[model samples]
Target: MTVPRAWWARLPDPVIDAVVVAVAVVDVLLSLVDASPVEQAMAALACAALVVRRRFPLPVFLLTLPAIMQAIVVAPFAALYTLAARSRDRRLLVACVIMFALASEASWLLNDLTSDDRTWTLVNFFYALAAVAVPVLLGQLVQARRDLARRLVEIEEAREHERLLHSQAVLTRERAQLAREMHDVVSHQVSLIAIQAGALQVAATDPDFKEGACTIRSLSVDTLDELRHMVTLLRASGGRASELTPQPTLADLHRLVTTSGIDAELTGELPPGTSTTAQRAVYRTVQEALTNVRKHAPGATATVRLWHADDGAAFGVTVTNTPPTRPSLPLPGAQQGLIGLRERAELLGGTFESGATAEGGYEAILRIPAGTD
Candidate 1:
């Protein structure tokens, strides 16, 4: 129940208990009346028990039962509130309330107030009812609010967990795609280079040139072997696999425009000799960005810009597309394109940014370390 974090949360347990105890002590002294010494002792016990009511709620409730039946002032009301807040057993709370009401009537009837004291008994019954209900109701309300807050927290945690699972699934699919693309594109093209080297090695009649061609062919074979092993060991997720094709580089910018079946323009230039890895990343960034434009903003004319210092210190690629005039292409989308592109750039010690442009277009940019081939 919400007893642990009730309104008295601001006050330490001992301090709140001291306040309650002081109130009960004052209440007892003010309401003292002619009673047997045994009843007086019981009332005193009830007042003292209020200090430990929260710690031992059930025991305190039992201890105060006699004092309540004897009408020992506010001790019984305080006990009832503590019990209602900490305990989930409604039957016990209801039973204690009934006992309190009956005791209120008995306290009046047993007095020497006269035989026609029915009206006074009724009024006292209502007062005792208020005392019992106000605390119990207040405690229950706090309990309900605490439960609601806990449930909301749990729901938010569940949502976060689901998002993580989805991310992991996406990562698995992307890894498989990488393996497939590397095997189908890189290994195949390298095998073609090896075949040409093998032909040159046999055709050349010079010993030095033939030996160089043989060396190139052997290196290509070794690379193909390693690439095949890597791809074979990779785990593939269940998704639509694209047909393996040659990986594009900066040289294929025009082909990508034609491949995307959209009006596109490209300008600027990378450093004279950038690393193959850096070039491939930029090409994929632009390719995916254009594919996204085709998917989300159909009929949008796109512009691709490349920038790099002649010294090859750093280079950047940017693609911006004007607002689409028509609806997007009717192809399914997974929305992971920009996310993957950003990851690719950052993995290479570069930065990537994509957002709506001030001129009412969308732009994706990537900056990576400039290195020669």
Candidate 2:
């Protein structure tokens, strides 16, 4: 059953109790006109007990029995309804119904034990029993309705969680498809360009033409290398290890520096037992810094320093390049690599810094917490 959001439904517990007690008091006043002094007092007591019916439903129902005998039924019916609504025992409710019916006819039974009208009294007792069942059924209906409402809320929340997971799965699949397209189409085209450049470099007679062809081939090859790494990252399945290949670390740094096409020196070493994550961060920092040196400062000489600082509390890498000996060509770049390096360092509870040195050189540094693993 749907719950009401009406003003009365939202009323506070104390206000609801007060309204019920007021109705019961009016009921007692109406019944007491023809009742004896003791019956009147019992009816008042029953009306007062309605205020606590929610907290002590069974005991309050018992207190209203005397009022039932006195023909003050409003309070007794209210108490019975409260007991049925709050209780989970069907057998207990059935017993309470029988008890209420008997209490309503107790005076008749005691005063006319040998009367000829006992058969008619029996009919009246059955009638009262049937009437008492109305409140009990209504109370049980309300209780079931409340339980169903709670179940609906839980079902809605579960559906929302499932929808979120579904959206994430769809997004992951799209990224994987895009990565495949880049590797198949884009990388293939770049590879063709590089092959053509190599052929031209070998066949050209002019010295300047051969140098130009070599530069084109070099640029195309570098583009392919960067694309391969990008595609691999896009296709990663969010596991502890890559499904396709291993990521770069300090072990790969020597090869990176040597093939970077710049005059650079590798020096110093990180302490043993350094984490793979930190090693990757250090590697990327050096890689990005050197790429910057090559793009913006041609013919520059660089130094790569890997160090353990603060008595092994931290470990980091530093790359510094001297001023360019030759002017650099205008290269298209968005500076996204530096941003990525900074974000990676932050993930490992570390820091990344890059700036121009006083001697007209550029410097980049990455420091990671030692506990990062």
Candidate 3:
């Protein structure tokens, strides 16, 4: 079983109370030589008030003032020191100063009978001030240090929050880039498979059926080989030099549209090496726009326009398509894709905007600054 302990044992409150009571009794006994019972009783009570100085410092000081005046020689200066250290209000400090000054002057007046009494009285006043100032100065120093430590902790927490936000942003961008790469690889291969399958189905009875089947098999094998090689390269290079492979630049817009089963043409000359960031942004914008077409605008042809100038210092890509007549499949939410595209472009110091055209077609426009390339 555990044992309980008294509060005083942990905090020394009872011991402090006992010390105050003892000092009051001693002061009362000493005052009996020249003071009456009422004066002695008042002095003893005032001295005992020091035990609650931390909680009621101003009240205790006010209560002790009468006793101090009655018997200044036995005024319990120790209680005054306790009051000064415990209280932080400037009013309390000012009160203490006034009291000290009065006590010094009073003592000087009483000891003016001797020839060198002025010197002795000044020395005694200085000693009393020292007793009160030492404890007050220490308390102020401790409070100042604690305030400084708290400010430092707040600053460190703010910095840590900023670092976490930065890390999350970087991780999000990398995941988007990975999604674009996977879309390019998988979409191109799947389109080829669908085309070969259609051709083989129509020529089943023809003499060249076997040759077409062989071609389909070879295409599938080639796709698998390329996927394996890309995965191996990604693992070996550890994602850093993985970008060494030519990313789908403006030149690849035609292939992207064809793979999406859309008869689209690229107009205007496109910029070259428009920064990895810009290239990735343009690729993702086109990839997402085409995927939307495949899912929601099946059998609808699209047009893509790429414009570049200033020696590849600026570039823009826009894709637009009319809605399909047949019932379209539900496309992914436009808000999410647009948000991701906006983030990608803003990160590369660019802009992206997409909306439905007045003619019932959807249009996506992306522009990037190539100066950062």
- TM agreement with the true structure for every prediction: 0.55, 0.58, 0.41
Ordered from best to worst lDDT, the candidate numbers read 2, 1, 3
Query: CA lDDT, every prediction?
Result: 0.78, 0.87, 0.66
lDDT of 2 by residue, 1-373 (tens): 3456889879999998898898888888887787778888888889889999999999999999988887888899999999999898899999999999999889888884655579878998999999999999999998887655654654455458669878878877787788889999999999999999999999999999999999999999999999998888887752224547588888999999999888999999998998888888888888889878866786789999999885778889989999986534455678899999999999999999999999999999898878898
- After superposing candidate 3 on the true structure, give the runs of residues whose Cα lies further than 4 Å from its correct spot: 1-36, 65-95, 104-115, 183-373
Clashing pairs for model 1 are none
- Best candidate, lDDT-wise? 2
Which pairs clash inside model 3?
Answer: none
Q: TM-score: which candidate is best?
A: 2
Candidate 2: regions farther than 4 A off: 1-4, 34-41, 113-116, 202-208, 237-373
Q: Write the per-residue lDDT of candidate 3 for residues 39-91, one digit (tens) a residue.
A: 77777677677677767766776667766556543334555555655555768
| Alpha-carbon RMSD, each predicted model | 21.3, 22.9, 22.0
Q: How much does candidate 1 score in TM-score? A: 0.55
Q: What lDDT does candidate 3 reach at residue 180? A: 53
Query: How many clashing residue pairs are found in candidate 1?
Result: 0
Better of 1 and 2 by TM-score: 2
Tell me which residue pairs clash in candidate 2: none
